[model samples]
Target: MQHILNRMIVQSMETDRSWFEGDLMERFLRYVRVHTTSDPHSASTPSTERQFDLARMLETELRSLGSTDVTLDEQCRLIARVPATGPGDPIGFMAHVDTAPDFPGEHVNPCVHERYDGGVIELGGGFTLDPAEYPMLSRYTGETVITTDGSTLLGADDKAGIAEIMTAVAYLTAHPQIHHPEIEVIFTSDEETGRGMDGFPVEKLRSGFCFTIDGTDEGAVEAECFTAYKATVSFTGYSIHPGSARGKLANATSMAATYIAMLPRSESPEATDDRYGFYCATEVTGGISKASATIILRDFDHDIVKRRISYLEQLARTIEGSFPGGKVDVNVDRQYLNMADFLAPHPEVLDRVRKAIAATGMEPVIHRIRGGTDGARLCERGIPTPNIFTGGQNLHGRYEWIALPAMVRASKTIVNLVQLFAG
Candidate 1:
């Protein structure tokens, strides 16, 4: 069944991509033009109304492809299903629609270098993507590279994922005899703000196992991710007149800064690599009377994670002990755990994925992710999912790019995975 489906997929791919005459760069440029940057400050489901623009567009595209049961949730998560040819568990391909909030996602004009000749690819005067600075540029010497216009982010961090998934689905739908299983497609909102799945109905997702096509590089595959937790520290202090407040008043801002300074300088995302754990302080804001700080804790090992949490608890206690009557409130919440705990038991999933990659004649580089993903939460929700690359590089930045051939190969790999599961 696998061999037969592969032949069919190859044949389907061979057909001139005339239908997909829609250029990915064109779609990506249009998507980036829309202001869909998620707002961590907003309380709304999507966290921003602009994200709906992309959500609605995807809904229409899916419906146009004759996909059945296409709909968008209140939170703006676009869900659709392409019925299975016969019988098999549904597999979902998920990607977020929102761009990162760290950078501007507005007025993005994507530029394409047709047949990149290597060397310095200038974004503008002075600012350029130099091969020497980013050695990765040397690899795409002969490929068409898409980048931003030096102002706003190219939004390829995810818009690339959306386009690939859409193109693959469009291909699958157009070729009915490809012999594939049911494909579940989900376009999530607010992923940039860590709330894409906040309102997602996991039970209604309709897929036993899913894969987030959100990885970097063409052949990269990930089955493990970080166990993430968020820690918050609040400091309350007595405020008095500045001149006479030296000993009588405690400055909350100073207290918060002190706590942040106490964090281990050698143990952070920038300082740590591989499987080593680290604590990252993301936000700190406060005034004289009240202050708050947010920190993220991550590790691959559950035992090590627990120990880190205990350390954080002790750190908070020690800070509270120093303030005498000052109030120190500490809150630690578990965000997501590593999916490896679940994927480990099901070696067949990895076996099938390995075979799929091998079938594509590409070397699969299996590595543990340094960050968290929707797959980690889904694993906790009883669905063992993994991460697959979309051939994108330098994600979440203005210098982001994706190779055309890599995108084509990834789509073929997706087709192969479906065929393998169909068998």
Candidate 2:
């Protein structure tokens, strides 16, 4: 019976050999297993030392693949150059290596659901993914999908992106006669922490434009994304004994609550979508003596984003004015700018992606990312980077998953994109 099962496995492999091309699935599995979660609170370059494990592994793999000019810097950014054959414009591909801190990114045990039937799927640890909640699962019928064991996130958010980019690198290397440009591939660190591109050696890149393989949905070509900022609103107040508090005490936490109360419910993330900007309070903490809240502002329009920041600053002042002994301080920092601002002038950049997606028999989706990627920062640095899909869904969570066939199409899209740049 065991021999019969082995023969069946061999037969399946023979029938679906194309699905395993470039070892995309195998690479993704290996990458997700590594604990590379980035810390948003850390002041370090990678935000976590564990990220270097994957960085070193990728460096070694690139060396073994005969890739040249490979380097892993102090910031944990890994870059590898694929020499051009029959020269054309240099192009680049990027993907982040660190998993999100939104959930447990350690001990990622990926489970393969072969030939999914578009139904509720069981993930261990008392978690089950329902098609009713995640409609995207319905689209993967008849395709192999990967999910976690419900203990931790699947890490498809960027690991899958890394796998797809590596597949492209491997393909372009073996098929040197494919007529391509000098390809620069980078694996970024701490993208989930929202500061991955900080100190990234963008000056070293030869590509005038690049694509970040950090998007969701199959065949997605993203040029628009949120212009992001993180704001910390801290409050200070005088504390007194309860008997004397009535007239002498200024409660800092109450001041914070007042500021939060002033935030418009209609203008929040839960209430907005598709080009609508939002102010989301991610963290709130303190006692009567001290209090603070972390809020993120996001919008597509530069003017609107500025207005939102102004609103935050004004609100802080108003909150302070309400209490004579209370002080409120708002500090806003730019996270990333929208990529469309840089990519719009390059219609040819978008056109090439559409053609490549079409070449893989999938219609290209001109998408707007509600969040940002490493591409946004690269674009800001004059690289004009856009985003491409990795066929991931429910990203940054335990319910995350990806379609095997979708990844194959994406891999094919990258191959075709490289050729399209040849002219």
Candidate 3:
């Protein structure tokens, strides 16, 4: 079985040079055109009704590609099975269907630049992606680059992952002699809003482990992620007319501003990198009578995250004392935890991924994810899932872009992984 898998890798390498035939890029372009931005405020499974549009389309595509047991659940998660030709543990591949709510994800007009000249790309509306700012652009000097028209986010965050997974599954289906084991492909919704795996049917997947194709750069394989929590601080103040506001009136907005100002400037998203954690204020809105601020706290250390939450509660009390008549409320909710905790017992899962990545002629770049992925939640549920990149950069914004050749490499890596697992 190992010998057969080795020969298969060699053949796949030769065919991968032109395997896509433009299908990968076409699928990505088509996906970004649909508006599937998730809403954080919604309590529904998908968090957005429009996510089904893409889910249904992917279901149709999966069935047409000869997939079996395809199912689109009520949560808008699309799962399918590619039949096996050999005996091995079934492998699972996942990617999200929804875009982030940080930026506009509607009417995305993607621009494809073939044989990029390694120069500054001017994406209209006075937005230009300067290579000097993002040196990674030079790596794909003569390759095909895809970007947004500067009006909306490109949705490459996970859509690029989706396209790569689809392309890999299609390639396997076309070549019946690949000798891979049964493969499970899943497309989840509301990943951006952090509820991606809330409705996931883990028992039904039946795979020993899974990999989430949702990261940046081609060689990255994320095994560690931050423990995440969301904190909401509400301030209630007494309102009075301006003429009598001297001592009786307490402004809620002013109290909220004070709390924000008290946050450590050194412990912010812009001030940290790598494994460093930070507290980020995502939203703040208020008037004279009532105001609320939503903050996202993250750290790789579970204890540190708890300390951060405690600090927030203490700060809220201090603010309440400063304003005699004002009341401050702090609420914290756990989002997800570091996958490393769950993955530690299953080092073989990451080892296999590294070997597969190296088989594609690229060094595996193992790194810790500062932000959470669906793998974090899935791993907590005993799936031992990790993240793989999709050749995307500047995700969740208009400057987001992807390299077609890099994406091809990612797809090739996926194919190699399947063969390795099956062997």
- Which structure among the candidates has the greatest lDDT? 3
Return the TM-score for candidate 1, rounded to 2 decimals: 0.89
Q: In model 3, what is the error at residue 146, expressed in angstroms?
A: 2.6
Go through the candidates in order and give each one's C-alpha lDDT.
0.80, 0.86, 0.89
Model 2 lDDT per residue over 244-313, tens place: 7876788999999989889889999999988899999999999989999999999999899899899999
User: What TM-score does model 2 achieve against the real structure?
Assistant: 0.87
lDDT of 1 by residue, 294-382 (tens): 99999999898788778877776777677655677879898999999999888878777777776665788887998888777888988
Instruction: Report the candidate with higher TM-score, 1 versus 3.
Output: 1
- Model 1 stretches astray by more than 4 angstroms: 1-5, 11-33, 238-258, 286-289
The collision pairs in model 1 are none
lDDT of 2 at 381: 88
Clashes of 2: 0
Q: What lDDT tens digits, residue by residue, belong to model 3 across residues 96-164?
A: 999999999999999999999999999999999999999999999998999999999999988999999
Q: What 10-residue stretch in candidate 1 is worst by lDDT? A: 16-25
Task: List the candidate numbers ranked by lDDT, top first.
Answer: 3, 2, 1
Cand. 3 Cα-lDDT = 0.89
